[model samples]
Target: MSSDRTLLMRPSPAARESLSALTPILHRVVERIGETNDITTLALEPLEPPSMNFRCGQFNMLSALGVGEIAISMSSAPHERMLRHSIRDVGAVSHALCQSSVGDLVGVRGPFGSDWRVESARGDVDQRDTVVVAGGIGLAPLRGAVEELVRDTQRGGGRIFILVGAREPSQIVFRADLESWKARGAKVSLTVDLATSEWDGRVGLVTTLLADAGFDATNSRAMLCGPEVMMRFTARALIDLGMDPEGILVSLERNMQCGVGWCGHCQLGPLLLCRDGPVVPYAGLVSQLLTQRER
Candidate 1:
């Protein structure tokens, strides 16, 4: 079997092309949707038609011209024509992105990294269950996968369950999408660490919702995106509930400068997160996830 390091070092040909080109493709922000007080979703249209189509879990390096660039995951589905990124005003570049107007031009570098591979999770049977867990803004990365999963479930595929956690009700990002997913037949549950007077749902850690989530652990695949601590505990919780560690996946974040393996900034243990993953199986990350300090 190839080691994780070896596997990560060998990126797909498309990724190699993206990494080789340092030039940014200019894209215009066609629309902006405010999700919360500090988070906004930008829909970008390339000046020319894009040459590549991004997959779920892939990230793009979005540049705010003079400000800087940041790696943001695509919140739009793979089939969409416009590239959508949900940005939070946590840093200078992100703040710039959040404040962008409908006609603003942004530089885009890639649709890089390993993907969630949601299509394969159901195998040939197409009846396997899928569970998605997102915390805070982490939902931005997993939104594409959830969208695909929802469509799959509608076509005689397995059941879909979405579990979300936020700091408060107002902190939740895809509010309307959550309602649409539930309306479309997904079993959706939400919880927050704190509650406002307007909130009437569950208030606790997202992990608590797992107990009541209905899924056959023997034939289920779980994907999680959140703070590292939250992912660590949630992955462990899923395992304790009889899910295989190998069947669980997590998306990680790091100080990524270059959106390729050439720069060593995003290394996590033996993996260069930019090339190897933002999304990876829990089985391959057990050692690193358990021992590595948060970056």
Candidate 2:
């Protein structure tokens, strides 16, 4: 990563030990929320006291017994007691997880990978702005960071701007949280690729909103999560506006079969996303992002 970027947090000793073991800690699903037609949020309670401590942008390996396991981002804030994962039913494992009922046992391992390190965005002066860009279900991974940013802004730290884009108004996840964040003073903007008759929001690529967004490009930090194509374009747009590439971060997704680095399934260029990233500075990924074919 770039010298200007914050170092990725290493897993704690307890997390490291947990990674060495393959067995998952079983948790019971306490609540299931339908965020959209395809996306669902599962709130889990540990069978024992919670020992896993995760930062924003970290992910957990969730297993649906007799099916398979998949990587899901933590959609709830770290300060929250229950563990929440927003899953999109894209495959067998995810579908099984989404179909899980209350009181069902789900296997969970790891609060792994790198983190968003939102605190670093506030430099010595602590007045730097935070710009968050999300596309489709990408908002799920960024929820924790957004919650922290909102609280910081409430404490009179700095400004926060959230720019989100989805396929349509109906596909927007965390609809209630978006309203609450806006009401709590974060500058929130919504856009869609397609619109309905009742829709009144902007209709265009999320990058288009950057021009009118009130933030200091030179001093602000940006965090983006979305499809590879969307993130590529958004990162480039931020660079064109004078933000340092090191100040821009992106969350990547891959076929992460193993939460540890032992498996090479999730390699992206020189980094193993399962261990080295999920969150990484854009400066280090520029070449790879430009050349690698999207999966």
Candidate 3:
């Protein structure tokens, strides 16, 4: 354990090179599965795997050779060999990337930005209980974290409660995974903004579920990912429930042109969302998060 901590304190040269943003490696699409009307999950096999590893909330910039490039978060956990991305087709780059067949090559430029801090949260003896709040496709980035928590729960590491919300029942991704996590002793709650006749579950905004999530706000860590508005409101709600502002983390989305900090496209205040964040604590982010760009 001491050696591991020492290694973390001083990353090797190869590890640093693996995290370089300027280079883009060629990754082949091994499989593509549709998640919803607009979302698709793509499995990419890298030509040469990087020496460095990625955390749960980190993202990669994927480029369709002829089209364009866009940022997508990995839905798979770090221990997983294949890089999995759950992307919603909101533009040309994302659509083109998702349209690839079994053996198409694409450019992968990252594993960038901050993480959900699940390790730090779980490692803290006082903060063993975790609260995960996600909405819509925002669940993509949080999925890896949730899986880790589930594994931890099985080993008696900590208790995790997942609260997810989507537009409707059909829009919920990883439904089976949620059930599996629940069966494994993790508490999972889901809600939708609108429901069909086939649905008999809760129907409302995700924040409403917080009242019954069964987590101790004062002693727990909360990680949120979703539309900016939803994250903002959810953070506020957690604060009201006595969660420390520093204990509340939120992932932000922006126009990230370059995977590195060179591009000013994703800058918010003095921090570049591509480099300094994507995942940031709520403690000192009031001004930047409340800014117009966040909305």
Taken over the whole model, the C-alpha lDDT of each candidate is: 0.85, 0.85, 0.82
Error of 2 at 108 (Å): 0.6
lDDT per residue as tens, model 1, 216-277:
87788899998888899888888888888888888888988888799899988888999989
Question: 1-295 in candidate 3: lDDT tens per residue?
Answer: 1545334333344754654475556667899988888898989986555533789899998888768888899898887767899989878998888788888877777889999876664464333688999999988999998888777666666688899999999999988788988998888999999999999999999999999889888888888999888888898899999999888888888898886888699987777999988989887655255446643
Across 70-141, the per-residue lDDT of candidate 2 in tens digits comes to 889999988887789999999899999999999988878888899988675444324679999999999999
Q: TM-scores, in order shown?
A: 0.90, 0.90, 0.89
Q: List the RMSD of every prediction in angstroms.
A: 7.5, 7.7, 7.2
Residue 294 shift from truth in candidate 2, angstroms: 5.6
Model 1, residue pairs in steric clash: none
Question: What ordering of candidates by lDDT runs from best to worst?
Answer: 2, 1, 3
Candidate 2 minimal-lDDT segment of 10 residues: 1-10
- Candidate 3's displacement at residue 177, Å, is 1.2
Alpha carbon deviation, residue 83, candidate 3 (Å): 1.0
**How does residue 175 of candidate 3 score in lDDT?**
81
Q: Which ten residues in a row have the lowest lDDT in candidate 1?
A: 1-10
Top lDDT model = 2
The residue ranges of model 2 lying beyond 4 angstroms of the native Cα positions read 1-21, 121-126
